[model samples]
Structure formats: C-alpha cells, structure tokens
Target: MMGLPFFRTPEIETPAEIEAASLRSDRFRLQRQVDWQRLDSIVTALENGRPRRISDEDLLDLPVLYRKTASGLAVARETSLDAATLAYLEALVQRAWFQVYGPRMGFTGWLRRFVGGGWSAAVRAIWLDICIALAVMAAGTLVGWLLVSREPDWFYALVPGGMAGGRTPGAGAAALRESLGTKPGSDGLSIFAASLFSNNTGVAIMAFALGFAFGVPTLLLLLYNMALLGAMLWVFADAGLGWEFAAWLSVHGTTELGAIMLAGAAGLHVGRTMAFPGDRSILAAMQAAGVRAAQVMAGCTIMLIVAGVLEGYVRQLVGDAAARAAIGTGMLLFWLGYFILSRPPRERET
Candidate 1:
C-alpha cells in the first residue's frame, strides 16, 4: 500500500522545455526593449547634465515613457521573468522615475536660495512676535535701570560677579574705563570669542526651545538678560563711561542682541501659533510655525557667530569710541537692509 502512491512524482523540465522558457523570456524583452532603451537614454541625458541634448518632444514624453516602463516592470515581476531582464527593468524604471520626479536643484542651489531671500522672508513673516519681544526687552532694561538706581544692592543681584570683573557700582571711573580697554596681548582673545559664542548660542537656543510653553518663559528670559544689560549700563553710566561703554557694547551688541531678539521672536511665534491655531489644528499650526521659526533661528545662529568675532577680535583691536560706534551702526544698517530688502521677486509679488 505504501509502495503504491496515487500520483507520480513530477519530472524536471526537459531540454526542450528549458529552451521554450528562454524563448519566452527573449520575446518579453524584445517587446519592451524599445521603450526601456528610450527611457534609459532620457534619464542618462539628465544625469549627465545635458538637458539641451534632449528634444522638447522627448521632455514631453518622459512621464509617459516612465509610466509605460514602470508597468512593464510590474508585469515582469508578476510573471516571474528571467533574472537579467528583471534587474534591467528595475534599474531602468528607477532612473526614469528620477528623471520624471526629483529635486531640480543641488545643495549649492538650495544654499544660494536661502541666503538670497529665504531667511529674510521667514523673519518678516514673524514680525508681530518681534515687536512684542522688543517691547518686553525694553521694559526689562528700564526695570533693571530703575531697580539699581533706587537701590545699589540690585546691581549685585542683577549682574554676576565674574561679569562684573571689578566693574562694580562702587568702582571708580578709572577702573571701569580700564575694564573697557583691550587687553595687552592676543593670548585670551580666541578663548574669549569661543566663550562668548558658546554663551550667546546657549541663550538663543534656550529662548527658542522654551517657546513651547506658550512663550512666557522666552519673554522672561529676554527680560532677565536685558535687565542685566541695563544694570551694567547703569554701572558704566554712573562712572561717567556711558558713551565709551555704549561704544564698547554696541560693537558686538548690535549683532548679538539682534540675534537674541530674533531667537525670542521665533519662540514667541511658535508659542503664539500653538496657543491660538486659528482655523487650523494645534499640531498643524505648530508645524507650519515651526518651519518659519526654524529659518529665523538658523539666521540668528549666523548673526551670533558674527557677533562673537566682533566682540572678541574687532572690539579688542579698535579702541576709539567713535570707530566702534560706526562699526556697530554699519552692522545694524546691513541687517536692516538685508531683512527688509532681500525678498525674492516672486515673494515681493505675493
């Protein structure tokens, strides 16, 4: 019983059967070979940066050819076509697909676009947040000035001892003036620049990162930092070094403070969007706002780097008060012009 199986074991394909399969595979390839070759040529031209070599008719035909070739790939996969034909079709379809729908520009082109107009547009988009943050910073500065003016103890409370660097409220005009002077050598300039850059970048990042809490933290952070500035301004102005102090501060402060303001504004933009999503859901609004805020923050980072260089090197090298003021004014003007005038033509139309 066990010896008598109901069905015979299936035999392997004969030589004739193997030949037949090969002929079928050949026929399949021959049917689609023309379309595949055309797609490959078009893709190769694009990849080689020879768009001019491709005819207008071929450009128009690209999507169609890609679709047809893609369909052939599907059929080959479903029917278990020969391995070589399968590989060729898969590769051809991929190339044709890229030609039909892919990023039109490279990284350099993207960077150019961003520097040329994209960043400024994003900043302009968040103008409301900027106005609010500016007002808060101003108020903070005034508060700091008043608090220290009313009680000298507030100066010690507002400014850290290391930052004070012996330029306290009681410090004489001579000591404060010397504090503003450039150090004798370049020994610590690099370290000073790196430290300033690190500190400023940290503040900027915190202002942005804390925006998720409805932007209150961002406002407070800006307020506290500006208050420190106001306290120091009082200390210097008290010592009759107000003009010199302003010049010293402005050489880097213009760019550095502007970056901080932008960072705060970016955070406010996100928080405000999430707090009041208007017609959109909170998630969607935050997503949209996050994109623009990110652009502004990216620009802020660049500004901070520039500020660090000015603070560390240029401020040290240039000692004249008027020269420092001029440099600061020039930087402010450049940023103003960049943000207001750098929109792309298309953006201007909209």
Candidate 2:
C-alpha cells in the first residue's frame, strides 16, 4: 500500500522471503523512497534474531541518520552495543538535530569553522587571532620600549587605568592570596562559567558594534585589548613576578587572549570591507563578510566557555607552580600546532 517504488515490486509473503530481501531492501529505502513496512520488517528481523543489516537507503534517511541506526547496526553486528555507544548515538542525534533544525553552530562553532573544519577549525581561528595579537604585541612592545627608554617618567601615562598603579609582581601573589582567602566552594565553577560567557559575549558585541563606526574603530579596539594585555604583563615584569605571573595567566589567559584576538580579527575584517569595498557594493561586501565574520565570532565564544571551564576547575586544582607552567605551555603549544601548522583542505575548491 505504501507509495515506495520498492513496495510496488511485490510483497514478500514469508519471513524467509524478506530475509533474502535484506540487501535489496536497503537499496529500495535509500535510492528510492521511504518504506515503512520494509523498515518495520527490518526491525522485526532484529527483534527475531537475525543479524542486523541496513541498506544504503537507511543511510540516506534523515531519521536513520539522526538515530545513527547504521552505525548502531554495524556496531551491534560486530560486537555488543555498549553503554558508551548508546550514549554517543544519542548525543549524535541531539547534535545533528541542533545543527540542522536549530540555529546552527551558534557564535562559537560558526566562528571556529571560518578557519577550518571541526575542532581543528577552531584551533586555526585561534592561531590566526594569536598571530594578529602578537603582531600588535610586538609593535606595542617596541613602542613601549622606546617610550620607556626615551622618557622613563612617562611610562605610567601610557598604561591604562586600574593597572597603571598596581604592582605587577605582587598582583598575582596578591590575587592568589585573595583567592585563597575565599572559600573553595562550588561557586568557582559558576564564576568561571559566567566569566567565560561574559567575556565571549563581550568579544562578539565589540566585533559587531565597532563595525558601525567605520574600520578604524575596530582596529582601535583590537589595539586597546592588546594594550591591556601588554599593560598587565608590564606590571608583572616591573614587579619581578617573573614566571609566576606567566604560570598564573597560563590557567586562563591563553584562552581569554585567543578569544579577544578572534573578536578583534572579526572586527578588523568588517572594518576592512567598509574601508575598501573593492568591486562589490559596500553593503553587499559587508553582508558577505558579516556571514563569515559571524562564524569566527561564534567560534571565539565557544573558546571562551572552554577556557572558563579550565580556569574555574583546573586552575583551582593546580596550586603548584610547575603544573601550572606545564599546562600553560602545553596549551600554548597545542594551540600553535593545531592552528599554524594545520594543513587544511585547499580553499580554492572548498
């Protein structure tokens, strides 16, 4: 009765006939049409003790894809389906649904995917952001050095508020002491998560908002973020905190800085289009760039969440200087290897 082309051939009267139909049924389901009766029959075969076998048709079906029935069947046939497999399948369905029917990968994955595919993509985005940040940092460092060298008294004027007077070498120690004073309660996770979310949202908002003021505003914002970082580091250096501050920052700064840079890059991209609309209309260019920029910003948001989680839980756990240093260095390296060195697919074809 089903409209499926496969069904039109004729119904198999007995279970034996259907068992023989397994391979062809797959073809019918996948290349042809939805055959609910055939699907039911396949399920019945499984329930009755036949080894699971799915057709290419099953693979093509959205419901089957969502359920990961093919994967499940393969796993089940090869070996017993474990709890982990079941859990993974469930997660696949949920994620697939979210990706397809929902709002896409959001601010996080979208931004990350701008650079590459999957986690690797996020890593690439971070790398690009870092390179840009470093360029700014190096330029700032040169300027700071020249300024400090030329006019020692004017160092304080160059640095921003709150940090201008804070003793850096002592800030981490002081912050640590203050952090120690607080009870190691459940609130750490919440605080970290909140910070992560807020920081990411801040980046996204800055990236989008600065575009309205022409490109210069976005570039200034990036420079401003870098200045804050440089100032913070300068304080640490002046205070003789040495590697202690580095280690402390390693816990959260890596991810935070990465996100900020990403936001900056996104902002820069928007501003660039505005400043030099080349061939295309400015609005058209902005829209095109906006879509891509949004993807990168979304990725940055996810990075913020991940960094926040690490800072909240892992940072609290690692009180030792060595472990913190290792983690910080490791994170930096991991990011470097993943982004700068990644051999992505040729963009020309993709």
- In angstroms, how far off is 179's CA in candidate 1? 2.2
lDDT of each: 0.84, 0.55
Model 1, 27-50: lDDT tens per residue?
A: 998998988888888899999999
- Whole-structure CA lDDT of model 1: 0.84
Off by over 4 Å in 1: 1-21, 186-196, 347-350
Which ranges of candidate 2 are over 4 A from the true structure? 1-133, 141-204, 340-350
TM-score, cand. 1 vs. native: 0.85
- Per-candidate TM-scores read 0.85, 0.52
Candidate 1 residue pairs that clash:
none
Per-residue C-alpha lDDT of model 2 across residues 1-350, encoded as one tens digit per residue: 11112112354589887666665445433542234334444444434545346565643464554444434434433433334443443444344454335663467664455556554553344354446555764665456545554554445665533434333333555543343222466342234334434644575468556865664565565555444445545555554554665676677667766666677666666777777779999989888767767766776776777787777677778866678889877877876676566555554661
TM-score (C-alpha, index-matched) for candidate 2: 0.52
